[model samples]
Target: MFVTRSVSDLVADSEGEGEKLRRSIGPVALTALGVGAIIGTGIFVVIGEGAKLAGPSLFIAFIIAAVTCAFSALSYAELASSVPVSGSAYTFSYATLGELVAFIIGWDLILEYGVSVAAVAVGWGGNVNEFLKATFGFVLPDAISKSPSEGGVFNIPAVFIVLLISVLLTLGTRESARLNAIMVVIKILILLFFIVVAFTSFHSGNFEPFAPEGFGGIASAAGVIFFAYIGFDAVTTASEESKNPSRDLPIAIIGSLVISTVLYVLVAVAAVGVAPVDTLSGSDAPLAAALNEGAGIPWAGGLLAAGALIAITSVVLVIMYGQTRIFFAMCRDGLLPRRLAKVHPRYGTPARLTLGFGVLIAILAALVPLDEIVKLVNIGTLFAFVLVNVGVIVLRRTRPDMPRPFRVPGVPVIPIIGILLCGYLIAQLPWETWLRFVVWLVIGLIIYFGYSIRHSRVRLGEKADAPSVEKA
Candidate 1:
C-alpha cells in the first residue's frame, strides 16, 4: 500500500493510450498561467478585505504573504522538477509520504481548487454585474445575482462563467492557454493603467496610521491576502502538459510568484494611496470604486470593471484546469473512478472530469455565498503546502540519490520554514473554517477507507501485467 511509483514508470504510463495529456505548454505559457490564476481575486477583491483589516499597511501584508509563499514555492519548484507529474502536492506526497497521505493532500486540494473556483466565480459575478450596469445601464436583481447568504436566490452569472470556461477547457488545453495568456496581458495593462492614473491623486494623509490595528491587524491582513498567492502551485499541476517539465516547471513556478508579488505590492500601495481605508473596505468593486469615487475618474471605473471581468475569468479557467488534473491523477491511481481519467480522444483533455467540475462549481457559484468559504480555501491550501514541505524533506532523506533538475537552495531550512509559516497561517484562520476543513477531511477519510483502499491499482497489482508499468 505504501509502494511508490517510480518517476520513470509514471512518465512511461503517461504515454499510454487515452491517458496522455498533450505537452504543448512552454515556460512562458506556464508562467502566464500562474500569473493569471494568482492575480485574480486577491488583487481585485481580497485587497479591500485586507485593507479593511490592516489599513494602509496592506503593502506590508502583501510582503508577508509573498515571503511565506516564497518558502513553499521553492519546495514546489524542487518537487515539480524531481517528480514531473500531473498531481502537484498529491503526486509528491504519494511518492514520498505514502498513498494515504497523498489521498489526504489530494482531498485537501479539492477544497482549495474547487472552492476557490467557486469563490472566484462569485467575485466574477459581482464584477459582471458592475460591468453590465456601467456599460449598458442593465442590472441583475439581487435574487438572481447573489447567493442565498447574500440575500440572492442564485448567482446565474457566476454559474454561466464556470460553464463557459469548462467548455473552453474541453475543447483543448493549448487553446485555453492562449486565451488565458491574452486575458492575463489585458488585466495587467489595466492594472498598470489604474496605478498610473491613481498615483496622480495620491494622498499622504491616507496612510496616516499605517498600522492602525497594529501587528495583529497586519497578521490578519496577511491571512486574508494569502488567498491571492494560492495559485502558483497550480502551475505544478500542469507538469504533464509542460514541454520540458524538469526545467520549465521550476521557472514557471518561481517566475509567476515573483511577477505576481511585485504587481500585488504596487497595486496595494496605489489603491490605498488613492482612497480612504473606509471607502475601500465598503466597496464591492474596490479598485474600480477607488478610481471612480476617490480618484474622480468615473470612466476609468468602467475600464477597470471590464478588466476585472477578464481577470476573474482567467482565474476560474486556470483553477478549474488544476482541479481536473488533480482528479485525473487520482482517478488514474484508482483513488477515484477510472472513467474520470478518460481523456477526450479528439481534444486530449479530461473532458468528463472538466464537465463534472463545471457542474459542481456552477451549483456552488449559483447557490452558495462564498465569502466565508474563501478562508476555508486558504486554510486548506496552507495545509497542502505544509504537507508538501514535509514531503520534500521526506524525499530527500529517503531517496538521496534521486535526480532533481532543480534542487531547493536550502533543503531543511527552507522546507522547515515553509511548514512553520503555513502552520501559522492555518492557525490564524477562524475556528469555524477549521471545523469545516475537519468535517471535509472526515468525509474524505470515509470515502478513502471504504473504497479507495480497496480499488487502488497500486495495491491491487492491476498494472503488473502492463509492460509500461514494469519498465521503471
Candidate 2:
C-alpha cells in the first residue's frame, strides 16, 4: 500500500540525524545564491536561442515565463517555510503525496539538477576557451576541449571544472556559499555593464515588426526562456542551511525570481535593440557578439566572456549542490542506498553523495553534447514544478491544521494557475522531449519497484506509524 509521509516526521528525521548540515546562510547570501544559479547560461546563451524563436517579442516571452515561475515560486515558498528541510520538491511530495509520487519527483530531480550542471559545465568550458583565445591567444586543442558529438575526443575543460567544484563543495558548504556570493556580484555587474553599453547603440528601427511570427513565436520563446528561471528552486534546497528558514526561504525564493526576471527582460531588450535577431541566433556567444560586432564595443566582449565563465561556474556549483541534497534526502529515507547519506565528519555536508554526483556529471559533461539534453532538463524541472503546485493544494486540504509560516496567497486558485501554466510550458517542449521524459520515468518506476519499495524505511517499520497518521 502507498502511504504519504507526514511533515512532522520529515522534520524529525532531519533533526534526529547524527550529522546535520550546518546553518550558515542568511537571507542576503541565500538571495545571492539564487541569483548566482539563475543568471548563468540562460542569460548568456539561451537569450539568443529564445530570440531566434520569437524575435524582438522575446521580451513578451520573458514576462510569460516569469509570471508562470512566480506562481510556482509561491507554492515553493509555502512548502519550504512549513517544512524547511533539504529535499526540495522531493520532500514536499513525500509529505503531501505518497511515497511513489515522492520517489518519482526525486528521480525527476536527477534530470533537472544533474543534466543542468552538465549543460552549464559545457557552457563554462566554451566561455573559458573564448577568454583564453581572446585575452592570451591561447586555445586548447579541439581534440581535448570539445565534446565527442562536436568532433572531439572529450571536453577536458568541462570535466576539469566539475571535478574542481566537487572539491570545493567537499571542503564545506559555508565556504562554497561565500565564494558563490562573490561570483554572483561579479556576474550581475558584468550583465549591467552589457546593458549600459548595448543601450548606447539601440536603434528604434529594430522594434519594427516586433512580433514577426506573432503570438505563436512568443509562446515558443517562453518555453525556451523558461530555462533562465530554472535556478530559483535552488533556494529551497538550501532550507536546511538557512539560519531562519521560515522567513528567509520565502524571501530568497521570491526575491531571486523577481530580480532575475527584471535582469532577463532588460538584457533581452538590449540584445534585440543592438543586434538583428538573425545575427544573434547564428552566434554561440550572443551577448558578447552583440557588444563586440553589433554595438562596436570590442573590449566589452572579452569582459562579458570572462563574466560568463564565472556565471556558469556558480551555476554548476549550486545545481550540483542541489543534486547532492536531493540524493541525501532520498538516501536518508531508504529510497536509495544509505551509504550515500553519510555526511563528512568534519565538514558536515553530504560528502559521499556530492562526490558521487560530481563524478557522474563530469563524465556526462566530458562526452555528451548537451544541447538536446538541455531541453530534457527543462522538461524535468517543469514536471517537478507541476507536482509541487499540486502538492500545495493536497497539503492544504489534508493538513489544514499544520503550521505554515509563509502561506501561499489565494490557496487553491494560485496553485491551480501554477499547475495549468506549468503544464502548458511542458506541452510547449518538443515531442521528442516528452518521449525522453516518459522513458526516464519508466526507468525510475523499475528502480522503485525493484529496490526502493522493498527497502523504504517506512516499509521496514522504522517510521510505519508516521505515514498512518496522515492516512487516517
Candidate 3:
C-alpha cells in the first residue's frame, strides 16, 4: 500500500525530505547551471565528428536533438515541480513507473553522469595541454596528457581535475553551484568570440554541397550530436533547491534548452562559415580553429583552448552533482545502502555518494580511453529521454488531476513526436552500441533481482494488496 500511494502522497513524501535543506537557488542561477552543464566539449570536439557523419545537415541534427530534449524537459519540469525532489527522473520513475524501471533509469543515469564526467575530464586535459604549450612554452609529455587511444599515455590531468571537483562537491553544493555559474560565463564569452570572429571570414562557397552525405548520414550525426544537448535535464536535480519549484523549475529546464540550441546553431554556423566543411569535420577543435582562420589572430586558438578547459570542468561538476543525488535517492529507497544516502552533517550534501562517484570516475578517467565509452553514454541518455516522454503520457492518464507546474503545451502530439524522434535517433547508432546497451540492461537486471528486489524498502515491508511488482 505504501508503494502504491497516490501521486499526492509521493509528492508530500518528497517535500518532507527536501524541506530539510535550504532553498537558495534563484531561477537565473538554475538556468546558468543548466547552461554550464550543456555548452562544453561537445561543441568543441564532437560537433566536428557529427559534421563528418552528417555533412551540412548537421544543422538539422541539432534541431532534431533539441526538440527531443525539449519534450523530455517539459515532462521533467512537471515532475520536478510536482515532487520538488533531488533525484530528478530517478525519483519520478520510482513514484510512477515502479522500482524496476526506476532501477534501470538509475543504471542508465550512471552513463549520463559517471561516464560523461570521465569523457569531459579527458577533453579538459587535452585543451589545457594545448593552451600551456602555446602560451607558456611548456607541453605536457605524451606520457601524461594523451589518451591511450591517441597513441600516448594516461590522461593524468583529466584524472587530477576529476579528483579536485569531487573534493569540491563533497565540500558543498552551494559552493559548487557558484563556481559553475562563473565557469558558464567564461564558456559563453569564448563561444561568442568564435561566433564574432568566424563570421568575418564567411565564404558562401563553403556551403555548396550542404547535404553531401545524404539523409542517413544526417540521421547518424543526430545520434552523435544528441550528446551536445545533454545538460537540460540536469536542472531537475536542483528541483529541491528552487525557491518556487512549480513556477521556476520548468522555466529553468525549457529556457536552458532554448538558449543552448540557439548558441549551438550560432557556433555551428560560424564554424562552417570560416572553413570548408571537410576541413571543419576533421578538426578536433573546430570553433577555435575557425576563429584563427577568420580573424588572423594567432591568440584566438589559445583563448578557445582556455575556454574548452573551463567548459569541460563545469560539465564535470554539474554531472557529478547529478550522479551523487541519484545515488542518494536510490539509497533512501533501500535499493542501495542507506549510508550512501546520508547527507553531510555540516554541508547538507551527500558526501559519501559524492566521494564514491568521484573516486570511481577518477579511476575511469585515468584508465579508459575516451573513444571507447562515448557511444554508451549517448545510448543511455536517449533511453532515459524516451522514458521521460512515455512516462509523461502514462502519468497523464493515470493521475490527471495531480498538480502540474508546467504542462507540455501540446501534450499528446509533443510527446508522440518526442517518442518517434528518440526512436529514430536510437536506430541510427551502430550495432555494437545496441549490444552494449543490452549488456548494461542485463547487468542491471542481475543486480536488481539479486539485491534491489530483496532489499527494496517497499518489498521488505508487507506486500501491498493492490497488484504485482509490475503493476505496482
Candidate 4:
C-alpha cells in the first residue's frame, strides 16, 4: 500500500525535456480553463434543484459547497505546485500515498471525467435543440438529438459536438485554451444578463423565511451543489502544458474557485430574490423562468438556452481535455502503453489519446442511458478529493523540505478539515452509489494487480533520486 514514487523522479521527468509536452498556456488562459469547467450546469440548472432542498437559503448552500471546494482547492494548489504532475490527484497519490492508491484514484478519475463529458454532451444536445427551435422554428428529430433512453435512435448532436471539440483539442492545447477562454467570457456575460433581469423584480418578501427548511436542508443542498465544482481541479491536469506551472497552476486552481464561488453566490441571491423558492424549484429552466416570471421577458428562455449550449460545451471541452491528459500521465508512468502518450510532432498534444477518448465518450453519450450513472460522477470526484487532502498531509510529513511555490497554510490542519468536509459530502450519497463505487474499485484492483503493478515505472527500478535521460 506504500510503494511510493520518489518525488525526484516526478520532478525530473519535466526537467531538461526534449520531446515532451509543451508549455504554451499562460496564467490567464489557465484560469479561463478552470472557469470553463466550473460555471456550467451547476449555476444554470442545479441551482434550481438546490433551491428545492434549501428554500430561500439556497445562497447559503452555495456558500457551503464553495467553502468545501476551497479547502480542497488549497490542498490541490499546494500539491500541484510542489509535485507538478499532470495526473492531478492520481499522481499526487503516487508521490505521497502509494502506487495502488494512485491506480484507484486514476480509475476513479477516468469514471468522473469520461462520464461527465458524456452527461454534459447529452445536456448540450437538449439545450441546442431548444435554442434552434426557438430561434429558427426548427428542431432535430428525437432520433438524432437524444439517447435511446430519451426515446432517440442515436444522439447525433451529442456525438457531433464531442468530435468537434476533440478535433479542436488535437490541433493544439493553446488553440483549445483560446476557444475555451472566449466561451467562458460569453457564458459569464450571459449569466450576468440573467442576474440583471432577475433583479428587475427583486422582492424582499422572497427573504421572509429564508431558512424555511433549516440547516438540515442547507447541508443537503450543499451536497447536491458539490458536483458543480468538480471541474476547477481540471486546471491542475494541464500542469505540463502551463508556461510557469508552480505559479500559474495554483493561481488558476484557487482563482477559478474564488471567481466561480462569487458568481455562484451572486446568481443564487438574484434567483431567490426574483421568485419564491417553490417556484424556483418547480421549473427545469429556473434561471430563464425567473427572468420571464419576474420581468415578463418572453425571450429570456431563448437567451438562456443559448447560454446553456455554450456553457455545457465548454464544460465538455475542458473535462474531456483533463481526462486525456491524465491518461497521458498514466501511460507515461507505464500503467498503460507508453506509445499511447506520444506527443503529436506537429501539434505538440496527445492527439491519439485525446481523439480515442473523444470517440469513446461520444459513443457513450449517444448510446448509454446515463441518468443514474451520472450520480457516480459526483462520488468519484469526492473520493479523489478525499485522497488529495490526505496526500497533502502525507507528503508534508514525508518531504518536509520540498520546494513549494505555493503552500497551504497551517499544514495538517487545513488538509484535515478538507478531508472531514469531503467525507461529510461523500456520506450524503445514497447507499446504492456506495455499492456501485465499491464494485468499480474492485474492478480497478483487479486491473492493478493483474497488469498495472507490474508495469509501473517506479516498480521497474525507475525510482532513483536522479533524473532519467530524456530521449529525443
Candidate 5:
C-alpha cells in the first residue's frame, strides 16, 4: 500500500515521449485549452448564485478564490514540470506519497472531473433554452429540456453537447486543441463585449454597502464560486499531450489562471455595476438578466446567450479531454484494465474511453440533479489540490536532487499556505457535502482493496512505461 514509483522511472518513460499519442500541442494551444476549461460554467452559470450570497462583493470572493488558486497553481506547476505525467495530482502523489494515497486522490479526481463535466453539461442545457427563447421566441418543452426534479423529463441539449464533444475528442487531440483555440478566442471577445455593454449603464451607487454580509459572506461565496477556478489544474492532465510539458505546462497553468482571474474580476464588477444584487441574483442567467432587464439591453443579452453556447461547448471538450486522459493513465498503471489505455491507431487518442465516459456523463447530465453537487465537486477538487501541494513538499524532502524546470519560490511555505486555505474553504461547505464525500470514499476503498491492489503494476512488480506530458 505504501509503494512508490521511482522518479528515475518517470524520467525514463518521458524520454522518447511521442510513441503512443501524438505531440502536437505547443504552449499557445495548451494555454488555450486551459483557458477554454477555466472560463466556463462557473462564470456563465453559477456566478449568480455567488452574487446572491455576496451581493456586489461577489468580486471579492473571486479575488479570494483566485489568490488561493494562485498559490496552489505554483505547487501544481512544480510537480507537473518535474513529473510531466498525465494523472495530475494523482501522478504526483504516486511518486511522492504512496499507492494508497495516490489511489484515493485518483478516485477523488475521477469524481471531480466526471461530475463537473456532467454538471457543466446540465448548465449548458439551460443556456441553450435561454438562447432559443431570446432569439426564436420559441422554447423547448420543459419535459425534454430539464431534469425530473426541475419539472422536466430529461435534458436533451445537455446530452447533445456531451455527445458532440465526445465525437470531437474521438477525432484527434490536435483537432480538439484547434477547435478549443477558436472557441477560447470567441468567448473572450464575447466577455469583452459584455464588459463594454455593461459599463454603458454602470452605477457606482449600486455598489453601496458592497460587503453586505461582511467577510463571512465573501468567504462563503468564495467557497461556492471557487468552482469557477476548478479547471486550471485540468491543464496539468494534458502534460502528456503537450510538446514540452516541463516548459509548457507551467506556462499554460499559470497563464490560464492569470487571464481568467482578470476576466472574473472585471465581469463580476461589470455585472454588479449594471444591476442591483436583488435583480441580478433573481434569475439563473445573471449576465443576461443584468443586460435585458437591469440595463435594458435585450440585444446584448441575446448575443450573450449565443456566446455561452460556444464557451460551454469548449469547456465540456477540455474537461472530458482531461478526465479521459486521467482514466487512461490509471488504466495504464494497471489499477484498472490496461487494455482500456490503448489509443486509437489513426487518431492517437483514447477513443473508446473518451466516448464511453462521455455517454455515461451524458446520461448523468440528463437524469441527475447537479446544482447541489457543485459544492460536492468543489470539496473534491480542493482535496486533490491539497494533495498536490503536499506532494511538492514531500518530493522536496524525498528527492532533493531532482532537476526542476520551474520551482515555487517559497518552497514549504507557499505549499503550506495552499493547504491551509483549501482546508478553510473545505470547512465552509455544509456537513451534508462531507457526508456524501465520506460515502464516496468508502466505495472507492472497496474497489481499491478488492481489485486495484492485485492489479497495480507497482505492487505486481511489473515494468511499464511511465506516463508523461508528451503524448505518444
Candidate 6:
C-alpha cells in the first residue's frame, strides 16, 4: 500500500530556511501577527452588510461564525504545533492527505491569499480616498479611484499599494512584521474609539426584528461574510519562524482568534446600534458612515476613514506575506519552480515569489472585478478548515505517539464538528461560488498530474519519508 508522508516529515523541510531565521518570532509578536492579520477591513466594511442580511441577529451570525472558526482554530493549533511550517493548511494537508489533496489546497489558498490581497487592496483605495476627502477635501477622479471591473479606467492607487507591500515583504519579514505591528496598534485603537463612542449612543430599537431575514438569511450571511475571518490563518503560516513552536504556536493561533472574535462582535454591536440594519448594509464605508450618523460628530467619518485605511493596509501586508510563503512552500516541494523558493540573500525572505505574487495581485487588484470573485476566498478558506480539522483526527490515530504540545480538547468531537460546520457554511454560499471553486480545483488537478506529481520532492527520494521534521 502507498503511504503519504506524515506531518512530521513536512515540518522537517524548514531546515532549508535554517534555525536562525526560525527563531526570530516570539509568542507575543506571533500573537500580534495573528491579530494584525485577523482584524482589518472586514470589521470596518463587512459587518454592516452581515447585519443588513441577518438583521440584529448579525450578532448571532458573528457568534456562529466564531464558533465555526474556533473548531478549526483548535485543529489548527494542534497541527501548527505538530507541523510548524509556512504553508498553512496546504503543507499540513500534503503530509496527511496525499499529493492530490495537497495540490487542491495549494490551489485553493491561491484564492484565499492572492485574491483576498486584491480585494483588500481595492478596499484600501476606497478608504484612502475617503480619508483624503474628509481631511483635505480632495478626492481621486473616478477614472483613477475605481477598479476596472467597477466601470472605471483603473484603480491606480490599489495597484500601487499592492506593489509597495510586495516590495516591503521581499525586503524582510522582520521589517514587515514591525510595520504591521504598529499599524495593528493604530487600527485597534480606532476600533476601541468606535466602541466607546457608539455605545454611549446605543439604541435598543435598532435591534427590533432581530432575525428579520430568518435562519436562512443569517446562515447565508455567515457564508458571504466569512472572509472577515480569513487572515488568522496567516498566523499559522509563521509557525516555522516562531521562537517556541510548540508552546507559542498554539497561543498565537488560538489567542488571535479569541481577540479577533471579541473585537468583531463589539464592532458589529456598535455599528448596528447606531443605524438601521438596512442602511448599514448598503453603505460603502459602513463603519465610518455609521459613526458619523450616530454621534452627530462631523469628524467621526474622517477618524473612521483614517482607521480603515490603516486597518486595510495591514491586511494587505499580512495577506501578501502569506501568499509569498505559501508559494515558497509549494516551490520547495517541487510542485512549482525551485527558483520561486529562493530566499533573498540580504532580506532572508522569499523575494522572487513575493515580487511575483505582488505583481499578480496588483494586476488582479487593478483589472479584475474582484467583488464577484470575493466569495471564493471564503469557500477556499472553509475547505482548508475542513481538511485541517480532519487532519487533527488523522494525526491523532496515525501518530498517537507523536508529541502534541497543544492538543485540542475533545479531539474527535471538535474535529468532527469543525468538518460539519465548515461544510454547512460552504453550503450556504451561493451556487456560483462553488462552481468557481470547482473550476479552480480542476485547473489544479491538471497542473498536479501534468507536472507536480512527478516532480515532487517526496517522489525523488531526497528525503522520502523524513523530508522535513516539525517540532511539537
lDDT of each: 0.87, 0.86, 0.77, 0.86, 0.85, 0.80
Cα-based RMSD of candidate 5: 2.7
Error of 5 at 68 (Å): 1.0
Mind giving the per-residue lDDT tens digits that candidate 2 earns over 1-472? 3588878878777766443677888998899889988998888888888887898888889999899899999999999999999989999989888899999989988877888888888888888889998787798888988899998999999999999999999889889999999999999999999899889999767777889899989988888788788898988889888999999999999999999999999998999898888768888889888887778877776798899899999999998988888888888888998767777767878887788888999999999778787655377788889988998999899989999999999989999999998887776677888787788899999999999998898778685223211111
For every model shown, what is its TM-score relative to the native structure? Answer: 0.94, 0.94, 0.91, 0.96, 0.94, 0.93
For residue 111, what is the lDDT in candidate 6? 70
lDDT of 2 at 39: 90
Residue 418 lDDT in candidate 2: 93
In candidate 4 the C-alpha lDDT for residue 349 amounts to 85
In the predicted model 1, the residue pairs found to clash are none
Clashing pairs in 3: none
Instruction: Output the worst ten-in-a-row residue range by lDDT, candidate 6.
Output: 463-472
Alpha-carbon error at 240 in model 4, in Å?
Answer: 0.9
Q: lDDT by residue for model 6 over 1-472, one digit each (tens)?
A: 0236666667666754331133477887788888888888888778867876798888778877787788888999999998888788888887678777877888888876887889889988888888999999999998998976677889998999999998888777877888888998888899999988989989989998888879988886776566677677888888777778889988988888888888888888888898777768788778777777776766888998998888888888887787777777788878877656766556777776788888888888888888777644477888899999988898888889888899999989989999998887777777888888888888888888888878887788666233222232
Candidate 1 achieves a global lDDT of 0.87
Q: Which stretches of candidate 5 lie over 4 Å from their true place?
A: 14-19, 375-377, 465-472
Q: How much is the lDDT of residue 305 in candidate 3?
A: 83
Candidate 2 weakest lDDT stretch, 10 residues: 463-472
Worst 10 residues of 4 by lDDT: 463-472
lDDT of 1 by residue, 312-394 (tens): 99999999999999999999888988767777767878888899889998998898767777645467678889988998898
RMSD of each: 3.0, 4.1, 4.9, 2.4, 2.7, 3.6
Q: Which has the higher lDDT value, candidate number 2 or candidate number 6?
A: 2
TM-score of 6: 0.93
Candidate 5, residue 135: the lDDT equals: 91
Q: Pick the candidate with the highest TM-score.
A: 4
